[model samples]
Target: MAKKTVEAALKVEKLKVEITKLKETKKNIDQKNKQLKKLKKKETKTKKSKVEKIEKKKTKKKKVTQLTERKTKEAKEKEKQKAKEAKEKEKQKAKEAREKEKQKAKEAREKEKQKAKEAREKAKEAKEKAERTLEEELQEQLSPEEIEGFQIEKVNMEKLTNKVCVILAEKETTGMIQSELWKKLKLSSRDGSRLALKLERMGTITREKILEKGRWTYKLIIKKTPISTESIENAPCLTCPVEQKCTLEGEVSPRTCEWIEDWVTIEIKKPKTAQ
Candidate 1:
Protein backbone atom coordinates (compact mmCIF):
# COMPACT_ATOMS: atom_id res chain seq x y z
CA MET A 1 0.00 0.00 0.00
CA ALA A 2 2.88 2.39 0.62
CA LYS A 3 4.52 1.90 -2.76
CA LYS A 4 1.31 2.56 -4.66
CA THR A 5 0.73 5.85 -2.84
CA VAL A 6 4.25 7.08 -3.74
CA GLU A 7 3.73 6.29 -7.40
CA ALA A 8 0.46 8.16 -7.51
CA ALA A 9 2.12 11.31 -6.07
CA LEU A 10 4.84 11.19 -8.70
CA LYS A 11 2.27 10.97 -11.50
CA VAL A 12 0.44 14.09 -10.11
CA GLU A 13 3.68 16.13 -10.16
CA LYS A 14 4.34 15.24 -13.90
CA LEU A 15 0.81 16.33 -14.91
CA LYS A 16 1.26 19.77 -13.21
CA VAL A 17 4.54 20.49 -15.08
CA GLU A 18 2.90 19.57 -18.40
CA ILE A 19 -0.05 22.01 -17.71
CA THR A 20 2.43 24.89 -16.93
CA LYS A 21 4.31 24.36 -20.24
CA LEU A 22 1.03 24.41 -22.24
CA LYS A 23 -0.05 27.71 -20.59
CA GLU A 24 3.28 29.34 -21.55
CA THR A 25 2.91 28.29 -25.24
CA LYS A 26 -0.70 29.66 -25.39
CA LYS A 27 0.55 33.13 -24.08
CA ASN A 28 3.27 33.31 -26.83
CA ILE A 29 0.72 32.48 -29.58
CA ASP A 30 -1.71 35.30 -28.36
CA GLN A 31 1.13 37.85 -28.42
CA LYS A 32 2.11 36.88 -32.02
CA ASN A 33 -1.57 37.22 -33.18
CA LYS A 34 -1.79 40.77 -31.66
CA GLN A 35 1.39 41.86 -33.56
CA LEU A 36 -0.01 40.52 -36.88
CA LYS A 37 -3.28 42.53 -36.37
CA LYS A 38 -1.28 45.72 -35.68
CA LEU A 39 0.74 45.21 -38.93
CA LYS A 40 -2.46 44.82 -41.06
CA LYS A 41 -3.98 48.07 -39.62
CA LYS A 42 -0.78 50.01 -40.41
CA GLU A 43 -0.78 48.73 -44.04
CA THR A 44 -4.46 49.80 -44.53
CA LYS A 45 -3.75 53.33 -43.19
CA THR A 46 -0.74 53.76 -45.58
CA LYS A 47 -2.85 52.78 -48.61
CA LYS A 48 -5.62 55.33 -47.63
CA SER A 49 -2.98 58.17 -47.39
CA LYS A 50 -1.55 57.25 -50.84
CA VAL A 51 -5.07 57.37 -52.39
CA GLU A 52 -5.73 60.89 -50.84
CA LYS A 53 -2.39 62.21 -52.22
CA ILE A 54 -3.26 60.96 -55.76
CA GLU A 55 -6.74 62.62 -55.60
CA LYS A 56 -5.18 65.93 -54.46
CA LYS A 57 -2.71 65.86 -57.41
CA LYS A 58 -5.59 65.31 -59.89
CA THR A 59 -7.60 68.26 -58.44
CA LYS A 60 -4.54 70.58 -58.66
CA LYS A 61 -4.00 69.68 -62.33
CA LYS A 62 -7.66 70.48 -63.18
CA LYS A 63 -7.45 73.91 -61.42
CA VAL A 64 -4.27 74.81 -63.40
CA THR A 65 -5.93 73.94 -66.73
CA GLN A 66 -9.04 76.05 -65.95
CA LEU A 67 -6.97 79.09 -64.92
CA THR A 68 -4.91 78.89 -68.19
CA GLU A 69 -8.04 78.77 -70.34
CA ARG A 70 -9.52 81.86 -68.62
CA LYS A 71 -6.33 83.89 -69.15
CA THR A 72 -6.19 82.99 -72.86
CA LYS A 73 -9.82 84.05 -73.35
CA GLU A 74 -9.12 87.41 -71.69
CA ALA A 75 -6.09 87.98 -73.92
CA LYS A 76 -8.12 87.29 -77.07
CA GLU A 77 -10.84 89.70 -75.99
CA LYS A 78 -8.30 92.46 -75.38
CA GLU A 79 -6.81 91.93 -78.83
CA LYS A 80 -10.22 92.20 -80.49
CA GLN A 81 -10.98 95.49 -78.72
CA LYS A 82 -7.62 96.92 -79.75
CA ALA A 83 -8.28 96.05 -83.41
CA LYS A 84 -11.67 97.77 -83.30
CA GLU A 85 -10.19 100.95 -81.88
CA ALA A 86 -7.52 101.03 -84.54
CA LYS A 87 -10.09 100.70 -87.31
CA GLU A 88 -12.16 103.57 -85.91
CA LYS A 89 -9.09 105.79 -85.70
CA GLU A 90 -8.27 105.16 -89.30
CA LYS A 91 -11.79 106.06 -90.39
CA GLN A 92 -11.63 109.37 -88.55
CA LYS A 93 -8.34 110.32 -90.16
CA ALA A 94 -9.74 109.69 -93.63
CA LYS A 95 -12.76 111.87 -92.96
CA GLU A 96 -10.57 114.73 -91.79
CA ALA A 97 -8.45 114.48 -94.92
CA ARG A 98 -11.47 114.76 -97.17
CA GLU A 99 -12.70 117.85 -95.32
CA LYS A 100 -9.33 119.53 -95.68
CA GLU A 101 -9.26 118.87 -99.42
CA LYS A 102 -12.73 120.30 -99.89
CA GLN A 103 -11.81 123.46 -98.02
CA LYS A 104 -8.73 123.97 -100.18
CA ALA A 105 -10.81 123.69 -103.38
CA LYS A 106 -13.32 126.27 -102.16
CA GLU A 107 -10.59 128.78 -101.39
CA ALA A 108 -9.08 128.35 -104.84
CA ARG A 109 -12.41 129.05 -106.53
CA GLU A 110 -12.89 132.21 -104.49
CA LYS A 111 -9.43 133.45 -105.42
CA GLU A 112 -10.10 132.87 -109.14
CA LYS A 113 -13.40 134.75 -108.96
CA GLN A 114 -11.70 137.69 -107.26
CA LYS A 115 -9.02 137.81 -109.96
CA ALA A 116 -11.65 137.91 -112.73
CA LYS A 117 -13.49 140.76 -111.03
CA GLU A 118 -10.27 142.77 -110.77
CA ALA A 119 -9.56 142.18 -114.46
CA ARG A 120 -12.98 143.47 -115.50
CA GLU A 121 -12.58 146.62 -113.42
CA LYS A 122 -9.15 147.32 -114.93
CA ALA A 123 -10.52 146.95 -118.49
CA LYS A 124 -13.35 149.39 -117.81
CA GLU A 125 -10.98 152.00 -116.37
CA ALA A 126 -8.61 151.69 -119.35
CA LYS A 127 -11.44 152.15 -121.83
CA GLU A 128 -12.63 155.31 -120.09
CA LYS A 129 -9.09 156.78 -120.09
CA ALA A 130 -8.66 156.10 -123.80
CA GLU A 131 -11.96 157.77 -124.67
CA ARG A 132 -11.06 160.85 -122.66
CA THR A 133 -7.65 161.10 -124.44
CA LEU A 134 -9.31 160.83 -127.86
CA GLU A 135 -11.82 163.54 -127.01
CA GLU A 136 -9.02 165.93 -125.91
CA GLU A 137 -6.99 165.29 -129.09
CA LEU A 138 -10.02 165.92 -131.31
CA GLN A 139 -10.68 169.26 -129.61
CA GLU A 140 -7.00 170.30 -130.08
CA GLN A 141 -7.18 169.63 -133.86
CA LEU A 142 -9.87 172.28 -134.42
CA SER A 143 -9.08 176.07 -134.20
CA PRO A 144 -11.51 178.49 -132.59
CA GLU A 145 -12.14 180.27 -135.88
CA GLU A 146 -12.80 177.01 -137.77
CA ILE A 147 -15.28 175.83 -135.13
CA GLU A 148 -17.10 179.20 -135.22
CA GLY A 149 -17.33 179.15 -139.06
CA PHE A 150 -18.53 175.55 -139.30
CA GLN A 151 -21.49 175.07 -141.68
CA ILE A 152 -23.17 172.49 -143.92
CA GLU A 153 -23.00 173.45 -147.64
CA LYS A 154 -25.82 173.33 -150.25
CA VAL A 155 -28.54 173.23 -147.59
CA ASN A 156 -31.21 175.96 -147.04
CA MET A 157 -30.61 177.34 -143.55
CA GLU A 158 -34.28 177.54 -142.57
CA LYS A 159 -35.11 174.12 -143.96
CA LEU A 160 -32.07 172.50 -142.28
CA THR A 161 -32.96 174.11 -138.99
CA ASN A 162 -36.52 172.85 -139.27
CA LYS A 163 -35.32 169.36 -140.09
CA VAL A 164 -32.87 169.20 -137.19
CA CYS A 165 -35.45 170.54 -134.77
CA VAL A 166 -38.06 168.04 -135.94
CA ILE A 167 -35.60 165.16 -135.57
CA LEU A 168 -34.64 166.22 -132.07
CA ALA A 169 -38.30 166.60 -131.07
CA GLU A 170 -39.07 163.02 -132.11
CA LYS A 171 -36.48 161.71 -129.57
CA GLU A 172 -38.55 162.84 -126.53
CA THR A 173 -37.46 164.40 -123.24
CA THR A 174 -34.81 161.79 -122.30
CA GLY A 175 -33.07 162.64 -125.62
CA MET A 176 -30.42 160.69 -127.62
CA ILE A 177 -26.70 160.37 -126.93
CA GLN A 178 -24.61 162.67 -129.14
CA SER A 179 -22.53 159.84 -130.68
CA GLU A 180 -25.66 157.86 -131.63
CA LEU A 181 -27.41 160.95 -133.03
CA TRP A 182 -24.37 161.80 -135.20
CA LYS A 183 -24.35 158.25 -136.60
CA LYS A 184 -28.08 158.43 -137.50
CA LEU A 185 -27.67 161.81 -139.24
CA LYS A 186 -24.61 160.60 -141.27
CA LEU A 187 -22.44 163.38 -139.78
CA SER A 188 -18.83 163.37 -138.56
CA SER A 189 -18.22 163.52 -134.81
CA ARG A 190 -16.39 166.87 -135.14
CA ASP A 191 -19.17 168.43 -137.21
CA GLY A 192 -21.88 167.08 -134.86
CA SER A 193 -20.05 168.49 -131.83
CA ARG A 194 -19.70 171.92 -133.49
CA LEU A 195 -23.38 171.96 -134.43
CA ALA A 196 -24.28 171.02 -130.87
CA LEU A 197 -22.35 174.01 -129.54
CA LYS A 198 -24.06 176.34 -132.08
CA LEU A 199 -27.49 174.98 -131.19
CA GLU A 200 -26.80 175.53 -127.47
CA ARG A 201 -25.76 179.15 -128.13
CA MET A 202 -28.93 179.74 -130.14
CA GLY A 203 -31.06 178.33 -127.26
CA THR A 204 -32.55 175.66 -129.55
CA ILE A 205 -31.14 172.67 -127.59
CA THR A 206 -29.17 171.68 -124.50
CA ARG A 207 -26.18 169.30 -124.06
CA GLU A 208 -25.86 167.26 -120.85
CA LYS A 209 -22.57 165.61 -119.86
CA ILE A 210 -22.95 161.83 -119.40
CA LEU A 211 -21.07 158.54 -119.38
CA GLU A 212 -21.84 156.15 -122.22
CA LYS A 213 -19.98 152.91 -123.07
CA GLY A 214 -17.48 153.72 -120.31
CA ARG A 215 -16.60 157.13 -121.89
CA TRP A 216 -17.48 160.74 -121.09
CA THR A 217 -19.86 162.14 -123.75
CA TYR A 218 -22.86 164.46 -124.27
CA LYS A 219 -26.66 164.00 -124.57
CA LEU A 220 -28.74 166.25 -126.85
CA ILE A 221 -32.23 167.47 -125.77
CA ILE A 222 -34.34 169.73 -128.03
CA LYS A 223 -35.87 172.97 -126.73
CA LYS A 224 -37.92 174.13 -129.73
CA THR A 225 -38.56 173.34 -133.41
CA PRO A 226 -38.36 176.14 -135.97
CA ILE A 227 -41.30 176.99 -138.26
CA SER A 228 -41.23 175.83 -141.93
CA THR A 229 -42.11 178.16 -144.87
CA GLU A 230 -43.52 175.27 -146.92
CA SER A 231 -46.83 175.57 -145.07
CA ILE A 232 -47.53 178.97 -146.81
CA GLU A 233 -46.38 177.97 -150.32
CA ASN A 234 -49.92 177.62 -151.71
CA ALA A 235 -51.35 180.84 -150.31
CA PRO A 236 -53.25 183.22 -152.63
CA CYS A 237 -51.46 186.41 -151.52
CA LEU A 238 -48.89 186.50 -154.41
CA THR A 239 -51.21 185.18 -157.20
CA CYS A 240 -54.31 187.21 -156.34
CA PRO A 241 -55.96 189.48 -159.03
CA VAL A 242 -55.91 192.42 -156.61
CA GLU A 243 -53.05 194.88 -157.04
CA GLN A 244 -50.72 195.88 -154.18
CA LYS A 245 -53.43 198.28 -152.85
CA CYS A 246 -54.85 195.71 -150.40
CA THR A 247 -54.74 196.98 -146.85
CA LEU A 248 -56.21 196.22 -143.44
CA GLU A 249 -58.95 198.97 -143.71
CA GLY A 250 -59.07 200.02 -147.39
CA GLU A 251 -61.76 199.23 -150.04
CA VAL A 252 -59.62 196.31 -151.33
CA SER A 253 -58.87 195.15 -147.80
CA PRO A 254 -57.50 191.62 -147.11
CA ARG A 255 -59.89 191.25 -144.13
CA THR A 256 -62.97 191.43 -146.45
CA CYS A 257 -61.60 189.45 -149.43
CA GLU A 258 -63.69 186.32 -150.22
CA TRP A 259 -60.98 184.74 -152.33
CA ILE A 260 -58.39 185.13 -149.52
CA GLU A 261 -60.81 183.65 -147.02
CA ASP A 262 -61.53 180.66 -149.23
CA TRP A 263 -57.80 180.07 -149.89
CA VAL A 264 -56.94 180.27 -146.15
CA THR A 265 -59.75 177.82 -145.29
CA ILE A 266 -58.52 175.30 -147.87
CA GLU A 267 -54.94 175.54 -146.67
CA ILE A 268 -56.00 174.88 -143.04
CA LYS A 269 -58.05 171.78 -144.00
CA LYS A 270 -55.16 170.08 -145.87
CA PRO A 271 -53.34 167.07 -144.22
CA LYS A 272 -49.97 168.15 -142.80
CA THR A 273 -46.78 166.42 -143.97
CA ALA A 274 -43.47 166.24 -142.17
CA GLN A 275 -40.75 168.09 -144.09
Candidate 2:
Protein backbone atom coordinates (compact mmCIF):
# COMPACT_ATOMS: atom_id res chain seq x y z
CA MET A 1 0.00 0.00 0.00
CA ALA A 2 2.95 2.43 0.60
CA LYS A 3 4.43 1.71 -2.86
CA LYS A 4 0.96 2.48 -4.66
CA THR A 5 0.55 5.74 -2.73
CA VAL A 6 4.00 6.97 -3.68
CA GLU A 7 3.31 6.33 -7.53
CA ALA A 8 -0.02 8.28 -7.34
CA ALA A 9 1.73 11.26 -5.67
CA LEU A 10 4.41 11.34 -8.39
CA LYS A 11 1.63 11.47 -11.13
CA VAL A 12 -0.14 14.50 -9.37
CA GLU A 13 3.13 16.55 -9.34
CA LYS A 14 3.64 15.98 -13.20
CA LEU A 15 0.02 17.28 -13.86
CA LYS A 16 0.78 20.49 -11.89
CA VAL A 17 3.82 21.31 -14.12
CA GLU A 18 1.72 20.86 -17.32
CA ILE A 19 -0.99 23.34 -16.04
CA THR A 20 1.64 26.08 -15.45
CA LYS A 21 3.04 25.71 -19.04
CA LEU A 22 -0.47 26.06 -20.52
CA LYS A 23 -1.03 29.39 -18.67
CA GLU A 24 2.23 30.88 -20.13
CA THR A 25 1.32 29.80 -23.75
CA LYS A 26 -2.11 31.53 -23.43
CA LYS A 27 -0.46 34.85 -22.33
CA ASN A 28 1.92 34.83 -25.41
CA ILE A 29 -1.04 34.28 -27.79
CA ASP A 30 -2.88 37.34 -26.28
CA GLN A 31 0.24 39.57 -26.84
CA LYS A 32 0.50 38.48 -30.61
CA ASN A 33 -3.26 39.33 -31.11
CA LYS A 34 -2.71 42.93 -29.81
CA GLN A 35 0.26 43.45 -32.21
CA LEU A 36 -1.78 42.23 -35.25
CA LYS A 37 -4.70 44.62 -34.38
CA LYS A 38 -2.29 47.62 -34.29
CA LEU A 39 -0.84 46.68 -37.73
CA LYS A 40 -4.36 46.41 -39.26
CA LYS A 41 -5.28 49.95 -37.98
CA LYS A 42 -2.08 51.45 -39.53
CA GLU A 43 -2.79 49.79 -42.94
CA THR A 44 -6.44 51.09 -42.99
CA LYS A 45 -5.30 54.68 -42.13
CA THR A 46 -2.76 54.71 -45.03
CA LYS A 47 -5.40 53.35 -47.48
CA LYS A 48 -7.92 56.11 -46.45
CA SER A 49 -5.23 58.83 -47.01
CA LYS A 50 -4.52 57.48 -50.54
CA VAL A 51 -8.30 57.42 -51.35
CA GLU A 52 -8.68 61.10 -50.24
CA LYS A 53 -5.76 62.18 -52.44
CA ILE A 54 -7.21 60.31 -55.44
CA GLU A 55 -10.59 62.01 -54.90
CA LYS A 56 -8.95 65.49 -54.85
CA LYS A 57 -7.04 64.76 -58.12
CA LYS A 58 -10.19 63.48 -59.78
CA THR A 59 -12.12 66.70 -58.74
CA LYS A 60 -9.33 68.93 -60.13
CA LYS A 61 -9.42 67.12 -63.55
CA LYS A 62 -13.23 67.48 -63.70
CA LYS A 63 -12.94 71.24 -63.10
CA VAL A 64 -10.41 71.51 -65.99
CA THR A 65 -12.75 69.56 -68.34
CA GLN A 66 -15.67 71.82 -67.37
CA LEU A 67 -13.69 75.02 -68.07
CA THR A 68 -12.62 73.76 -71.53
CA GLU A 69 -16.21 72.72 -72.35
CA ARG A 70 -17.51 76.16 -71.29
CA LYS A 71 -14.91 77.87 -73.49
CA THR A 72 -15.99 75.82 -76.48
CA LYS A 73 -19.65 76.75 -75.87
CA GLU A 74 -18.76 80.46 -75.74
CA ALA A 75 -16.81 80.16 -78.98
CA LYS A 76 -19.80 78.51 -80.69
CA GLU A 77 -22.11 81.27 -79.44
CA LYS A 78 -19.77 83.98 -80.76
CA GLU A 79 -19.61 82.29 -84.16
CA LYS A 80 -23.39 82.07 -84.31
CA GLN A 81 -23.72 85.75 -83.45
CA LYS A 82 -21.21 86.68 -86.18
CA ALA A 83 -23.10 84.59 -88.75
CA LYS A 84 -26.36 86.27 -87.78
CA GLU A 85 -24.80 89.73 -88.20
CA ALA A 86 -23.42 88.81 -91.61
CA LYS A 87 -26.81 87.50 -92.74
CA GLU A 88 -28.52 90.69 -91.61
CA LYS A 89 -25.95 92.78 -93.48
CA GLU A 90 -26.56 90.85 -96.70
CA LYS A 91 -30.33 91.31 -96.36
CA GLN A 92 -29.87 95.03 -95.84
CA LYS A 93 -27.68 95.26 -98.94
CA ALA A 94 -30.26 93.38 -101.01
CA LYS A 95 -33.02 95.67 -99.82
CA GLU A 96 -30.96 98.73 -100.72
CA ALA A 97 -30.14 97.29 -104.16
CA ARG A 98 -33.84 96.69 -104.86
CA GLU A 99 -34.67 100.23 -103.79
CA LYS A 100 -31.99 101.62 -106.09
CA GLU A 101 -33.33 99.59 -109.02
CA LYS A 102 -36.84 100.91 -108.41
CA GLN A 103 -35.54 104.46 -108.30
CA LYS A 104 -33.68 103.96 -111.58
CA ALA A 105 -36.77 102.56 -113.28
CA LYS A 106 -38.87 105.49 -112.10
CA GLU A 107 -36.27 107.94 -113.37
CA ALA A 108 -36.12 106.23 -116.76
CA ARG A 109 -39.93 106.26 -117.09
CA GLU A 110 -40.07 109.96 -116.24
CA LYS A 111 -37.34 110.72 -118.77
CA GLU A 112 -39.24 108.89 -121.52
CA LYS A 113 -42.44 110.82 -120.73
CA GLN A 114 -40.56 114.14 -120.83
CA LYS A 115 -38.97 113.25 -124.19
CA ALA A 116 -42.35 112.33 -125.68
CA LYS A 117 -43.81 115.62 -124.44
CA GLU A 118 -41.01 117.62 -126.04
CA ALA A 119 -41.38 115.76 -129.34
CA ARG A 120 -45.14 116.47 -129.43
CA GLU A 121 -44.56 120.18 -128.76
CA LYS A 122 -41.92 120.44 -131.47
CA ALA A 123 -44.17 118.70 -134.01
CA LYS A 124 -47.11 121.03 -133.23
CA GLU A 125 -44.93 124.16 -133.66
CA ALA A 126 -43.50 122.91 -136.98
CA LYS A 127 -46.94 122.11 -138.38
CA GLU A 128 -48.24 125.62 -137.50
CA LYS A 129 -45.18 127.28 -139.11
CA ALA A 130 -45.55 125.24 -142.30
CA GLU A 131 -49.27 126.11 -142.66
CA ARG A 132 -48.57 129.84 -142.14
CA THR A 133 -45.75 129.85 -144.71
CA LEU A 134 -47.90 127.96 -147.27
CA GLU A 135 -50.77 130.45 -146.80
CA GLU A 136 -48.46 133.46 -147.24
CA GLU A 137 -46.93 131.99 -150.40
CA LEU A 138 -50.39 131.26 -151.81
CA GLN A 139 -51.57 134.84 -151.05
CA GLU A 140 -48.47 136.39 -152.64
CA GLN A 141 -48.66 134.36 -155.85
CA LEU A 142 -52.46 134.59 -156.52
CA SER A 143 -53.83 137.39 -158.80
CA PRO A 144 -56.78 139.45 -157.51
CA GLU A 145 -59.10 137.95 -160.16
CA GLU A 146 -57.98 134.36 -159.34
CA ILE A 147 -58.26 134.98 -155.57
CA GLU A 148 -61.93 136.01 -155.91
CA GLY A 149 -62.81 132.57 -157.39
CA PHE A 150 -60.20 130.51 -155.39
CA GLN A 151 -62.62 128.54 -153.22
CA ILE A 152 -61.64 125.37 -151.30
CA GLU A 153 -63.30 122.17 -152.55
CA LYS A 154 -63.05 118.43 -151.87
CA VAL A 155 -60.34 116.55 -153.77
CA ASN A 156 -61.45 114.85 -156.99
CA MET A 157 -62.25 111.14 -156.58
CA GLU A 158 -60.32 110.21 -159.72
CA LYS A 159 -57.23 112.08 -158.53
CA LEU A 160 -57.46 110.41 -155.13
CA THR A 161 -57.84 106.98 -156.76
CA ASN A 162 -54.77 107.54 -158.96
CA LYS A 163 -52.77 108.72 -155.97
CA VAL A 164 -53.71 105.62 -153.93
CA CYS A 165 -53.01 103.30 -156.89
CA VAL A 166 -49.61 104.92 -157.42
CA ILE A 167 -48.78 104.59 -153.73
CA LEU A 168 -49.68 100.89 -153.68
CA ALA A 169 -47.71 100.30 -156.90
CA GLU A 170 -44.61 102.03 -155.53
CA LYS A 171 -44.61 100.21 -152.19
CA GLU A 172 -45.15 96.81 -153.94
CA THR A 173 -46.24 95.58 -150.50
CA THR A 174 -48.56 92.57 -150.06
CA GLY A 175 -50.71 94.35 -147.41
CA MET A 176 -50.92 97.72 -145.64
CA ILE A 177 -52.66 99.15 -142.55
CA GLN A 178 -55.27 101.93 -142.91
CA SER A 179 -53.16 104.35 -140.87
CA GLU A 180 -50.14 103.61 -143.05
CA LEU A 181 -51.95 104.76 -146.22
CA TRP A 182 -53.17 108.02 -144.59
CA LYS A 183 -49.60 108.85 -143.54
CA LYS A 184 -48.45 108.77 -147.19
CA LEU A 185 -51.67 110.26 -148.61
CA LYS A 186 -51.82 113.14 -146.05
CA LEU A 187 -55.62 112.62 -146.04
CA SER A 188 -57.80 112.82 -142.92
CA SER A 189 -58.65 109.47 -141.29
CA ARG A 190 -62.36 109.65 -142.25
CA ASP A 191 -61.56 110.56 -145.86
CA GLY A 192 -58.89 107.90 -146.13
CA SER A 193 -61.29 105.31 -144.71
CA ARG A 194 -63.94 106.28 -147.27
CA LEU A 195 -61.43 106.09 -150.10
CA ALA A 196 -60.30 102.64 -148.99
CA LEU A 197 -63.93 101.42 -148.81
CA LYS A 198 -64.57 102.75 -152.28
CA LEU A 199 -61.52 100.98 -153.65
CA GLU A 200 -62.62 97.71 -151.99
CA ARG A 201 -66.10 98.04 -153.54
CA MET A 202 -64.50 98.57 -156.95
CA GLY A 203 -62.58 95.27 -156.40
CA THR A 204 -59.24 97.11 -156.70
CA ILE A 205 -58.25 95.87 -153.18
CA THR A 206 -59.49 93.62 -150.38
CA ARG A 207 -59.83 94.79 -146.75
CA GLU A 208 -59.52 92.48 -143.76
CA LYS A 209 -59.92 93.35 -140.07
CA ILE A 210 -56.75 92.82 -138.01
CA LEU A 211 -55.87 93.76 -134.43
CA GLU A 212 -53.18 96.45 -134.21
CA LYS A 213 -52.28 99.04 -131.53
CA GLY A 214 -54.83 97.40 -129.21
CA ARG A 215 -57.61 98.16 -131.68
CA TRP A 216 -59.12 96.67 -134.82
CA THR A 217 -57.57 98.04 -138.02
CA TYR A 218 -58.11 97.34 -141.71
CA LYS A 219 -55.48 95.50 -143.74
CA LEU A 220 -55.61 96.56 -147.41
CA ILE A 221 -54.65 93.70 -149.72
CA ILE A 222 -54.15 95.35 -153.13
CA LYS A 223 -55.23 93.59 -156.32
CA LYS A 224 -53.34 95.92 -158.60
CA THR A 225 -53.08 93.57 -161.61
CA PRO A 226 -54.53 94.98 -164.86
CA ILE A 227 -56.34 91.67 -165.58
CA SER A 228 -59.64 91.91 -163.79
CA THR A 229 -61.61 88.83 -162.62
CA GLU A 230 -64.46 89.96 -164.93
CA SER A 231 -62.14 89.44 -167.91
CA ILE A 232 -61.72 85.78 -166.86
CA GLU A 233 -65.49 85.22 -166.48
CA ASN A 234 -66.04 86.78 -169.94
CA ALA A 235 -63.50 84.52 -171.65
CA PRO A 236 -64.42 83.46 -175.23
CA CYS A 237 -63.78 79.73 -174.50
CA LEU A 238 -65.85 79.90 -171.32
CA THR A 239 -68.88 81.01 -173.41
CA CYS A 240 -68.27 78.89 -176.51
CA PRO A 241 -65.98 75.78 -177.20
CA VAL A 242 -68.46 73.13 -175.83
CA GLU A 243 -67.89 74.15 -172.17
CA GLN A 244 -70.41 71.45 -171.01
CA LYS A 245 -68.69 68.61 -172.88
CA CYS A 246 -65.05 69.60 -171.99
CA THR A 247 -63.61 66.69 -169.97
CA LEU A 248 -60.48 64.51 -169.74
CA GLU A 249 -62.09 61.67 -171.82
CA GLY A 250 -64.64 63.63 -173.86
CA GLU A 251 -64.30 64.95 -177.49
CA VAL A 252 -63.77 68.56 -176.23
CA SER A 253 -61.14 67.84 -173.61
CA PRO A 254 -58.61 70.36 -172.15
CA ARG A 255 -55.90 67.73 -172.53
CA THR A 256 -56.72 67.28 -176.22
CA CYS A 257 -56.84 70.97 -177.08
CA GLU A 258 -53.42 72.30 -178.19
CA TRP A 259 -54.06 75.85 -176.97
CA ILE A 260 -55.21 74.71 -173.48
CA GLU A 261 -52.39 72.15 -173.09
CA ASP A 262 -49.72 74.63 -174.14
CA TRP A 263 -51.04 77.37 -171.90
CA VAL A 264 -51.39 75.16 -168.81
CA THR A 265 -47.94 73.62 -169.31
CA ILE A 266 -46.32 77.08 -169.28
CA GLU A 267 -48.61 79.12 -166.97
CA ILE A 268 -49.23 76.63 -164.10
CA LYS A 269 -46.38 78.12 -162.04
CA LYS A 270 -47.14 81.75 -162.97
CA PRO A 271 -49.77 82.92 -160.42
CA LYS A 272 -49.93 86.37 -162.13
CA THR A 273 -51.44 84.81 -165.29
CA ALA A 274 -55.04 83.50 -165.32
CA GLN A 275 -54.83 79.75 -166.15
Could you give the C-alpha RMSD of every candidate to the true structure, in order shown? 13.4, 20.2
| lDDT for each residue of candidate 2 in 51-161, tens digit (9 for 90 to 100) | 877887788788888887888888998899989989999999999999999999999999999999989989988865544432234446655455433322465455556
Best-matching candidate per lDDT: 1
Consecutive 10-residue window with the lowest summed lDDT within model 2: 266-275
- For model 2, what is the error of residue 46's alpha carbon versus the real structure, in angstroms, after optimal superposition? 4.8
Which runs in model 1 stand beyond 4 Å of their true positions?
A: 1-36, 95-275
Off by over 4 Å in 2: 1-46, 117-275
TM-score of each: 0.39, 0.29
Identify the candidate with maximal TM-score. 1
